[model samples]
Target chain A: MDGYKGFLGLLVSSLLVGFLSVIFTLIWVLHYREGLGWDGTALEFNWHPVLMVTGFVFIQGIAIIVYRLPWTWKCSKLLMKSIHAGLHTVAAILVIIALVSVFDFHNALSIPNMYSLHSWVGLTVVILYILQLLLGIFIFLLPWAPLSLRAFVMPMHVYSGLLIFGTVIAAVLMGVTEKLFFALSGYSKFPPEGVFTNTLGLLIVVYGALIFWIVTRPQWQRPKEPNSVLLQPNGGAQEGAGGLTVNFSNVDTPDSKLNHEASAKKRNFTADEVGQRSTM
Target chain B: MDGYKGFLGLLVSSLLVGFLSVIFTLIWVLHYREGLGWDGTALEFNWHPVLMVTGFVFIQGIAIIVYRLPWTWKCSKLLMKSIHAGLHTVAAILVIIALVSVFDFHNALSIPNMYSLHSWVGLTVVILYILQLLLGIFIFLLPWAPLSLRAFVMPMHVYSGLLIFGTVIAAVLMGVTEKLFFALSGYSKFPPEGVFTNTLGLLIVVYGALIFWIVTRPQWQRPKEPNSVLLQPNGGAQEGAGGLTVNFSNVDTPDSKLNHEASAKKRNFTADEVGQRSTM
Candidate 1:
C-alpha cells in the first residue's frame, strides 16, 4: 500500500512539474528572442536562473507529495520509514540546488548591490522550505504522532510551494520584461503559448479547497466506542460491533435496575432479551 | 439582530469604499501631475481608466457586504425587505457610474489599429463588471439561494477584479517605464513609480488571500449545522455525547434490558451515574 501510494504521488508530481518546466522554458526562450533580438550571448546568461529554479521547484514538489501520501492509509512500518528518509534527502538536495543557483547568479551577474535584498529574501524561502521538509520527514517517521502534526506539515508544504512558485514566476516575468540578466537578449512581448502557470495556480486553489473540505467534514458517521480492554484484561470481547458486547447479567440485579433503565433510555432500547446478547 | 448586523455591514462597507476611493483619487492626482507636464493638459487622461476601475471595485465590495448582512433578524420583514431593495438601488447607481466611465474612456483613447483588439477586450471587461454588479445585487436579494448560485456569482466578481486590476497594473508599469503615455504627450522620462503599481498588485494579492480564507475557512471548520429550518424537523435529541443525534431505533426492535446491558458493558453512562448506582 505504501509503495503504491508513493509511486502514485511520484507520478502526479512528475507530470505536473515536467509540464510546468516545459512551459517555463518556452516562455523564457520566446522572451529571450523578442526582447534581446535573438542575441546568442544574452540567451546563454538569461537561461540559468529560470532553469535552476524550475528544476528546484520540480524536485521539491516530488518530495512534498511523497511525504504527504502515507496519511491516506496504514502501511508497513519499514516502507513508511524508508520513504520518510528518502523524501528528506530529495528535499535537501533541491534546497541546496536553489541556494547554489542564487549564489552563482549573484557572483556572475554582478546584480546591483541594492538588489541583494531580493536575493536574501529569496534565500530565506529556501531555508524555510528545507526546515519544513526536515520536520515533515521527522513527523512521518514517528508512528504514534498525532494527526495535527500531519495537518501542520501539509500547510507548510503549501505555503512554501506558493513562495517558491511566486518567486520563480516573478523572476521569469522580470527577466522577460527587463532583460535583467542579459541586456542584449530579449523575449516575446506576448505571454507564453501554454497557460500552464495560470492552470497551476488554479490547481493550487483547488488543492486548498479539497484540504478545507476534508478537514471540516462532519464526524457524526463514526462514533467512539468504549475502552473495554481495561475491564477484561485479556481483551476477551472481540467479535461484536466494533469489538464490543453486552453482558446483561452484570446489570440484572435489583439494585442496578434503575441504573440499567437510565442506560437503556440513553441507547433508546426497551427492556428485552436481545440486548443481553454477548460476544465471545 | 438583523437590523444591527445590517447596520454594521453598511458601516464597514462604507468605510472600506470611502477609504479606497480616497486612495485611488490620490494616486490619480499624482499620476495626473506626472502626465500633465508632457501633454500640456490640466487633467491627464491616462489615469482615468485605472482610477475608474479602482473606484468601481470598492463600490462593488460595499454592495456585496451590505447585501449579505443578516437583516431579517432585527426588523419586520417589510422593513428589512425595503432596506434590501434600497441597497440594490445604490449598487445599481454605482454600476451606472462605472459604465459611463468605461464609455467615456473608450471614446477618448486612441491606439494603433492593430491594438483595437486590446481596446475591445478592455470594453468587454467593463461590460462584464457592469453585469457582475447587476448579478451581485440579484444575489444579495436572495441570500437563501443554493450554494451553487453563490459559487457562480463569485467567479464573475473574481475574474472581473483580476482583469481590471491586471490591466491597470500593466498599464501603469508600461507608462512608468517606457513613458508610453508621456511620449504621446511631451514628457522626457518618468521616475520608477512602477514600483508603487507593483505594491498595488501586492494589495490585490493580499485581498485575494483574505477572500480565499473567508470563503474556505468555514469549509475547513465543521460544516455549519444545516440551518435552523432543516434541524427543526428532528426532535432535539442530543446524539450520543455530541449534539448530532442520529436516531437509528427503527433499524431494530427497542430492547430496554439488552440496551442497558450493552450500555453498561460499554461504559456509556456518565461517571456520576456509576457512583449513584454503586450506592444503590
Candidate 2:
C-alpha cells in the first residue's frame, strides 16, 4: 500500500510539473509569435493544453489513491474509497484511449480520427464527475451517516464535479478557439472564432480556486467513537470493566473468612431462620 | 442564535439575488445596445463588465457568509459577530450618505460635496470583504475545528480571491482588447464587437464554473474526533455535585462502596491476613 501510494504521489507530482511546463511553453509560443510578427496561423500546431489537461487528470487519480489509504474510516473513508474506485476506473479507461490516440496505435486512425477519441474521453470524464456528484448526494441522504460527514462530503462532491466540468469546458474551448482564430486569419480552413474556446482558460483557473476553498474549510461537528458502551447507562461503570466479578451478599463483612462462612450458612438457612437472623 | 442565523441567511440570499440580477441587467443592456445599432463611442464605456463584476462581489460576499455559518466556533463566532456589527455600521453610513446625496441633505448644512460618500461606501464594501477574508483565514486555523470547516473556508478564500482576481483580469482585458481591436479596426474608438462582448461573457461563465468546482471538490481530509482520552477527557461526564468527577479507577462492581471500604481496611491489616481475606 505504501509503495503504491508513493508511486501515485510521484506520478501526480511529475504530471503537475509537466503541466506547468506546457503552460510555460504556451506562453513562450505566444510571445514568440508576437516577436516574429507572424499571425496566429503561422504558429505550429500546439498540444500544450492537451498535455496540461492530461496532467490534471493524473492529479485527480492521485487524489483518489491518497484518500483510499487504510487509515481512513467512517463516512469519509467510505466516501473517499467509493469515489476513488469509481473515478479511477473511469479515468484509467480514458487515459488508455488517450494514450492510444496519442501514439497512433492503429495505422487506420488518422489525426482527424483522434479528435473523436479526445472528445469522447472528455465527455466521459464529465459524465463520471456527474455520477460522483450523485454519489455525493446519496451519501448525504444515508440515514446512519453523521450530519457533519454529510456537510463535508457535499462540498467535495461539488468541487470534483466542477473540476471535471471545467476540464471539459477548457477542452471544447480550445478546439473551438483554435478553429475560429485560424479561420478568421484566412490562413486556415477552420472557423474564425469560437465562443467556447475564448472562455475556457479563465474558467479553469477560477474553478481551481473554488475547489481549493471547498477542500480547506474547517468542520465543527465530527463523528464520535463507534462504541456505545463508552457512553453506557449506570454512570459509565460498563466502560471500566476488566473481567472481574463480586457478590455483595457474600462479602458484607470486613472479616473475609467469617463473612464468607456466614454467607454460605445464610444461603442454606431456612426462611424462618433467615427472617430471625434479619430481625437480629 | 437561530434568529441571527436566519437573518444572516436572508441577507446573504438577498445579496446573491441582487448581484445576479445586476448581471442579468447588464446582459440585457448589452443585447439592447447591439439591437439599437449603438456605434463605437457608446460601447467604449463598457459599463457592463464593471456592473457584472460588482454583482460578482456581492455573490462572493453571500457565499462567504453561507460557508462561515455552519462551523463557527469561539473566536470565529466573535469575529463574525464583529463583522456583522461593522456591516450594520457601514450600512447605516451608506444609507445616510445616499439620503444626503439623493435628497440634498448636504445642502442644508451648506455643503455641496457629499457625493463622494457613494464612492466611500463602495470602497468600504470592498474593504469589508478583505476583512472577512482575513477572519476566514484565522477561523480555518483553529484547533478542534472540523476538517470540513477548513475545507469549506479555504475554497471560499480562493473563490473570493479569484473573483477579485478575475475582476481585475476582466478589467485589464477589457481595456487592452478594446484598444487592440480599435487599432485593428482602423478607428481610435469603435463600438465593442459581438465577438469581444461574447468572449468576455464566456470568460465570466467559465470562471463561475471554476468557482463552483473549487467549492465542491473533496480533497481536504475531513476533521476527525480525537481518538485519545487526553485530547477530550471531559467529554463523557455529565454535570455532578462538584461540577463533574471523571472516575478513572477500576472499582466498578455493584458493591463498589463496600469494596472500597474493605480495601481501605485491608491496607492497615497484615499482608498475610489481606491475602487470606481475599481467598475467603
Top model by DockQ, which number? 1
Interface RMSD of each: 18.3, 25.7
Candidate 1 at residue A253, lDDT? 14
Model 2 C-alpha lDDT per residue in residues A1-280, reported as the tens digit of each score:
2234543454445445435534543553354232222122223233324433444443443443343233442444345435555555555454444444334422232223222212433445546665764564355323343332333343345345434634443343333333333233521222212222233333343334333322221111111223210111112111121011000000011123433433444433321100001110
- Alpha-carbon lDDT of model 1: 0.33
Q: lDDT score, residue B163, model 1?
A: 34
Q: Enumerate clash totals for all models, in the order shown.
A: 18, 37
Classify candidate 1 by CAPRI docking class.
incorrect
lDDT of each: 0.33, 0.33
TM-scores of the candidates are 0.45, 0.25
Q: In model 1, where do residues sit more than 4 Å from their true spots?
A: A1-24, A27-45, A52-280, B1-25, B28-204, B219-280
Question: Ten residues in a row with the worst lDDT in model 1 chain B?
Answer: B271-280
